[model samples]
Target chain A: MNTVFFLVFGLIVVVCAINVVVQRHPISSAISLIGVMGSLAIIYLQLGAEFMAAAQIIVYTGAVMVLFIFVIMLLNAGSEEGGKGPLTVRLLGVPLLLVFLGLLSYLIQRLFSDTGPVRFGDFKGGSPADVGRALFSTYLLPFEITSVLILIAILGAIVLARKELD
Target chain B: MPAAVPLSWYLVLSAVLFSLGVAGFFFRRNIITMFMSIELMLNAVNLSFVAFSFQLKQVSGNIFAFFVMVVAAAEAAVGLAIILTVFKNRATLNVDRIDSMKY
Candidate 1:
């Protein structure tokens, strides 16, 4: 069951991630990124990070992606101009990327050879209550700091995005 | 009984996603698409974090992933605003074209 869930959602994530890159228009890419995030949420559930899964949906797919789409729309972002760049990049880009991916997988597999298979229900500490407790207690400082970070981001965004007065 | 997925497989998937994100960042000319690629990379890392959290039987990985998500949110807000400013000044979203500071 766990394997099946992982394969299905994992496939969705990979395909959508590729779509996000391959699509020409920014809006199309944004929507594809949302697809990637949604499938990742399900994978999070399979991994027993239930709270993270919900937050992935609400914060990432819901709020962050909405902001992305709004920016694309407001800017009237058109499709990328047609020109695949120079010959070396066009010819070698994908093959080099594949090599890089293969190298990363090889390294990860060798490093994690001793770890056990991930079983569903094995980690029950990912519930919201558990995460909230950790956030408020052990991670209290970081949590408070993130609020300040967010406040600064809000102010920065407003200042940067507002109209330029004469 | 259900088949077991090795922990390395999850890491491998994360690697693949991260690589794709890198590919997008380098190959795509559009600024927004490039920014989205950065977001994709962040999500890929978050997956790895959660998987390690599950492996170690600790909720700390999930907490870390939560923090990553919060930071990604803040980043998106500020990043989009920056993109808007860039667009207003340059009137083009192509990353290659936006290079006015190229010496």
Candidate 2:
């Protein structure tokens, strides 16, 4: 059951990830990355990280992707120029990547076959309440630091992106 | 209950995504695309972290993953700002074309 779950979302993530890399247009890549984020959120939920799943959707797909799209539109960056690199490199790279993936999957299966299966309800320690408690307690310092960092980022982005007065 | 997926499968998926990110970073010519690739790589690592959190039955892995997200968000904001500045000066987004800094 869980294998089927992973297989579906995993395939979606891989394909969309490839799309993000292969698309010439930045907008298209941004959309594909949003797809990747959605699927990864599903996988995160399957792994019992419910809060992370929600955060992944809300942050990565919703906020970050919107930011990307806004930048793309603002910049008016059309599709990339064609013929990015040599024909030989493009022709041979696909097959080489296939072989690499095949080898990696084989090795991973061989190594983890005996590590037992991962059922849906394996470890349920990733709830929001748990994460919140941890965030405010053990990880409090980092949380505060991150807030400060975000403020700095906002300031820097505004300063750099705004039109010059002079 | 039905048979579950192996833990390794999740790890393998993460590895595959990370490889694609690396490929994008290397193959793409656009600066924004390259930055997107880096985000993809960060996401792949986040998946791995959550997977390991499940494996170890600990909350710390998720904590680490959260921190990674925070860092990535910060990086993206600052990076895009810098990109904006570069575009203002150079009038292009192509990595190869932005060669004024070269020796």
Q: After superposition, how far is residue A36 of candidate 2 from its true place, in Å?
A: 0.4
Model number with the top lDDT: 1
Over B2-41, each residue of candidate 2 has an lDDT whose tens digit, in order, gives 4687788898998899889988887898999999999999
Instruction: Tell me the whole-model lDDT of each prediction, alpha carbons only.
Output: 0.93, 0.88
How does model 2 score on DockQ?
Answer: 0.63
In model 1, state the lDDT of residue A11: 94
Which sections of candidate 2 miss by over 4 Å?
A: A86-113
- Each model's fnat? 0.92, 0.66
lDDT of 2 at A107: 85
